[model samples]
Target: MKRFHVHVVVPKLDESVRFYSSMFGANPTVLKDDYAKWMLEDPRVNFAISARGGEAGVNHLGFQVDSEEELTALREQVVAGSVEIQDQPGAQCCYAASDKYWTQDPAGVPWETYHTLGDIPLFGADSHEKTVAGASSACCAPAVSIPAVVQRKVGCG
Candidate 1:
């Protein structure tokens, strides 16, 4: 079965962690200096927080698979279906050990599937820093532009 979770960005990692710990009545299972995540097993949801750009709120949310084999098979299925696979399996990312595949629907909403294997690389305190930076550098493209519009009064051009 696929596991679903949301990743929330936070301005203050420590503050968020403390608040969540109190609200949930349990400490986060995975805690790093720059990142913290609470695996609420009872509810089967993962709430994660990271201190990056001092921005708070949802990052990217999706399902977590159970094994590498599952992830690899999913990737193959996605590819065989001819739906573009955004990220192929075998890429190290997000402080999680596993293979993953990212796919987007026709409406442009993204979905991800992966299986966690073991500990993830710190990449210097903030794991997202390295991962996000590499993405921007390698996968990023120029933003598309839109034409500006001008409004006129009834009598004014």
Candidate 2:
């Protein structure tokens, strides 16, 4: 199964967390000082919020696949569609490490499709990502021209 993903950049983390928790009727599955995530089965969405700069609105939308086969199929479809893609293997972000594909939709909205590999302690895209060519994404947000996000901490390898 593939879960829909939506990441929003907020002006205030706690405030947004409060609001969304009220709306969703549950606490976040993952919560940090500047980030929170709700892996909700009701809507089957991986909804996340972070106070990591950018304007207060939707950061990016995506799909979180369950297996490597699904991800490979997705990548094949993207490649066949002629959409430009930035591939990140072992990417650290959103308090988790993932294999991600970054691209934009027809309206140019940034979209990420990834398969989470494991969790990380922090919320920043670490220096290890810099090793991947063209992998300049920050923590919890797409590197594409989605919006102006705050610079990530350096050397968090």
Best by lDDT: 2
TM-score computed on alpha carbons, candidate 2: 0.85
Model 1 CA deviation exceeding 4 Å by range: 72-83, 105-109, 123-157
Alpha-carbon local distance difference test for all models:
0.59, 0.81
lDDT of 1 by residue, 1-157 (tens): 6567667768888899899999888998888877778888777877777775533666556677787677777778767766665553444545665555555555444555767666656522232322322443111110111112223346756
Clashing pairs in 2: none
**What is the clash count of model 1?**
1
Across 55-153, the per-residue lDDT of candidate 2 in tens digits comes to 889988999999888998998997776667767777788789898877776676888899999998978658545422554656655554533232345
TM-score of each: 0.66, 0.85
Please state the error at residue 14 of candidate 1 in Å.
Answer: 0.9
